[model samples]
Target: MRLDKFLKVSRIIKRRALAKEVADQGRILINDRVAKSSTDVRVNDKIEIKFGNKTLIVRVERLMDTTKRDDAELMYSIIEEKYERDFKNE
Candidate 1:
């Protein structure tokens, strides 16, 4: 799936446009490298999102076109330490 779509469908960024904008601004990374909105996301890939004062790191567990709110949570696993580290450094 596209990184922007995946983020929205997985309920990570809440909106596709926001995902695209953030990605275009180089605020999103895949496998630790800057990623664009069109970046392909696959299972097991690591994603990091930087937003002003916060950062989120998640391991892609699944790539779905659509999912229920509850099921969406299963799409990725939060890496709290990594997230916290990035946030702290921000």
Candidate 2:
């Protein structure tokens, strides 16, 4: 799946437009490299999202065309979370 589409379908970013915007802004990384909104994503890949001073890292668990809200959490596993304080240290 496309990174932006995966983010939206999995409810990671709430909206497809927002996901695209963030990805275009270079705040989204795939496998530790910045990725465009149209980047292809696959299972087992690492995704890093930067929001202001917070950074979220997750590993892709599965890819699905359609998913329920309750099942979205199963799509990825949270690998790391860094808050404002943690970002400052990095």
Candidate 3:
């Protein structure tokens, strides 16, 4: 599955357009390397998304064409989530 499509199907980014935009901006990484919107997503692959002040890491567990809301969480497992504190505003 494509990275953008998988992000949407897994409800990671909420929308396909947003996923593509994020990916294009180099905010998405596959296996520690920068990935494009059209990048291929495979099972067991690690995906890291850097958005806002948070960094999310997830492992691709499975892929499907369409998934229900309840099943979306099953597609990927959250590996780690780190929120960077913005001390500049303090």
Candidate 4:
């Protein structure tokens, strides 16, 4: 699945366009490397997203063309979440 599409389908970003914009701006990483909107996403891939003052890390657990709201959270597993305070310490 495409990174942007996966993010939207999984409800991680809510919209595909916004996800594409974020990826284009280099705000997302896959397996510790910068990822583009068209980047391929696969199971077990690590995805890190920088959202303003917060950072989120998740591992792709599954991929589906479409999923219900209740099933979206199952697509990825949260690995770590860092806030502004965490960044200040690093």
Q: Where in model 3 is the C-alpha error above 4 Å?
A: none
Q: What is the TM-score of each candidate against the true structure?
A: 0.88, 0.92, 0.98, 0.93
Worst 10 residues of 1 by lDDT: 80-89
Q: lDDT for every model?
A: 0.90, 0.94, 0.98, 0.98
Would you list the clashing residue pairs of candidate 4? none
Among all windows of ten consecutive residues in candidate 2, which has the lowest summed lDDT?
81-90
What root-mean-square deviation over C-alphas does model 3 reach?
A: 0.5
What does candidate 4's lDDT look like per residue over 5-69, in tens digits? 99999999999999999999999999999999999999999999999989999999999999999
- Residue range 1-90, candidate 3, lDDT tens digits: 999999999999999999999999999999999999999999999999999999999999999999999999999999999999999999
Best by TM-score: 3
Spell out the clash pairs found in candidate 3: none
Clashes (backbone N, CA, C under 3 Å), per candidate, total: 0, 0, 0, 0
TM-score of 1: 0.88
Per-candidate Cα RMSD to the true structure, in Å, reads 3.5, 2.9, 0.5, 2.7
Residue 21's lDDT within candidate 2 is: 98
User: What's the lDDT for residue 90 in model 3?
Assistant: 96
